[model samples]
Target: MGTFVNNAWYVAAWGNEVRRELLPRTLLGQQILLYRKENGEAVALVDRCPHKLAPLSLGELKGDSVQCGYHGLTFDCSGTCIRVPGQRNIPTEAQVRAFPVMEKYNAIWVWMGDPEQADTTAIIDVPHYGDPGWGLVDGQYLHFKSNYLNITDNLVDPAHTSYVHKNTIGNAAGEEVGVKVEQSDSHVLAYRWINDAPQVPLVERMGKLAGNVDRWQYYYLHLPSISYVDFGCIPVGTEPTEANKDRGFRSFSFNFLTPETESTTHYFWLHLRNYHPDDPQASDDVARLMNQTFEEDATLLEFIQREQERTGVREYARIAIDNAPLRIRRQIERLQSKEQSAEAAAMDCEAETAIR
Candidate 1:
């Protein structure tokens, strides 16, 4: 029902959210218990106890193990059965599946599919993060009831900002501006050039310039369920001489949409730059602005998903702007097909090997 292939990283939560106390979080419709060890290493395990199906999150947290409240069954960080109360011997089969997890850039990512396929190679690279000169900002998570594909579609179309986000970052001038789009194997990049446009509400102004202003926007829909947007401004000053002009602004944001089920998604995000990571006041302001934008998108997508479900429409018409979403869906389909073919081939090889 959902497109969680065998080898992608899904953001579970912010690194700060998981503490010593075991917390229960739902991802891909599966409830999970998360906590950190005494040494501050985070661990994730299936929340349900194998013995009685009781939630492990409701149990007690020891130094490095979680004890199920129902039967005092204790499990370690690796999901291994460490202790069984009042029992002389522990069965070799008594264990819960442990998911591989890692923390990067202040967020925790979990592998939900095949353990053998999971690799650190799949983690996305954020070039601007930790760059000495650029500022880094803290990001937040948002929960949505819409299909993840719809969200990817929305990010690719900057044209919708003028209408859908009219009160926020949308400006009348943006709609009138000319845009050029280019395509690649994994992404679509669009740029808009505006000349002497008037400053509008909700949009950040880079001040008036005599020459043209370059606004670059790029969207990348990575396989499985990750998407990113890069937006920035390059201002050309009024004077013919380039002596007094200020350096322009640049920023990048990413969305990791982990499907909780067929109709639900967990949206994790990180807002980053080369300069802002240590500036508390600036980071707080940026966080507030980014949260507002996410709220707007989440509200609209939720309503759209509900309507589509109610109507039971199979084929909905799309416009030219929907190109990125269509491209992403095609890529996902290809990956799924390839995986199935590989599995079938492996099975056939095994059959022959057995006969020999």
Candidate 2:
């Protein structure tokens, strides 16, 4: 919530974004260079060259290594200096810091903390990814001029949809629906069901619903910043069970929030829907609609962030709808606290060992 939880894995770029060419990006306040090696493996390193602090992004890519544009110093994918033109001895500190990165679910994830603790298994799963019956819309990106926490708050709170996304995914019928909240060690879920109601605009256009339907919105914030909504609709009077819900029109919409700075965020999103799996037209329509909806949020959030900065106040009041947002804030604080405690303990151990 405060800047970022660096110990966690964050989406650095989409799989297609990183290539043999050098690409520069800022994540968690650190400038990083991302590229793909000859074998198609993604690599991330500190953008600065150790020799003169020149940005590695300004350099040329040689094979899998980056050559500084000014000088002839070269660094490999591991951030080790493998070549130093006109030099016989390479300085021990001539290397840059390399980050742990991997490609999964069509996204490239990077670890910005202690490299030893970068466990790839900790990445959140996209269940419907690569499944036969799901239509996938991925490689979408947006830049939000707001803190990642602010975006997270909006994501887990469903009440704003009725107002913020009226033209796209929201309507007045869901204005008063009550939300149920639940939390586990790693995630918080806030969900609500709107029964005997007309489908929202997008759903109405996409699905063949009759008169009224039982629609659900499950906003799940998976630790730190990843969010996905389990949203769908079923005909009215149908049993509200998992199997029936899956059989109905359903979608898994994901948002991977990566903090670029305290005041800005990188939003990477993808959507998977059960219906229209093979309809290219439907996929294009979904992309257009979802992009419009998110842009609506981005515009509002930028203004909200500017005002918050002016007043130095995040909020003036809290309501029942804040249950999920509040829970996520507390969870994030706990994670930060735990990380700090672990770091301090490790420092103490190192100090004690050095003294002995």
**Most accurate candidate by TM-score:** 2
If scored against the real structure, what TM-score would every candidate get?
0.85, 0.97
The models' CA-based lDDT, in order, is 0.72, 0.92
Q: What TM-score does candidate 2 get on C-alpha atoms?
A: 0.97
* Per-residue C-alpha lDDT of model 2 across residues 1-356, encoded as one tens digit per residue: 36578789999999989989999999999999999999999999999999889999999999999999989899998989999999788999999999999789899999998899999999988977999989999999999999999999999888898999988778899998988999999999999999898888888888656678999999999989999999989999999999998788899999999999999999999999988899999999999999999999999999999999999999999999999999998998998998889999999999999999
Tens digits of per-residue lDDT for model 1 on 70-140? 99999988888988999878888779989999899888889877688888777888866777666666557
Could you tally the backbone clashes for each prediction? Answer: 9, 0
User: lDDT of candidate 1 vs native?
Assistant: 0.72
Provide C-alpha RMSD values for all models, in order: 3.8, 1.3
Sequence-dependent TM-score of model 1: 0.85
Clashing pairs in 2: none
Error of 2 at 5 (Å): 0.2
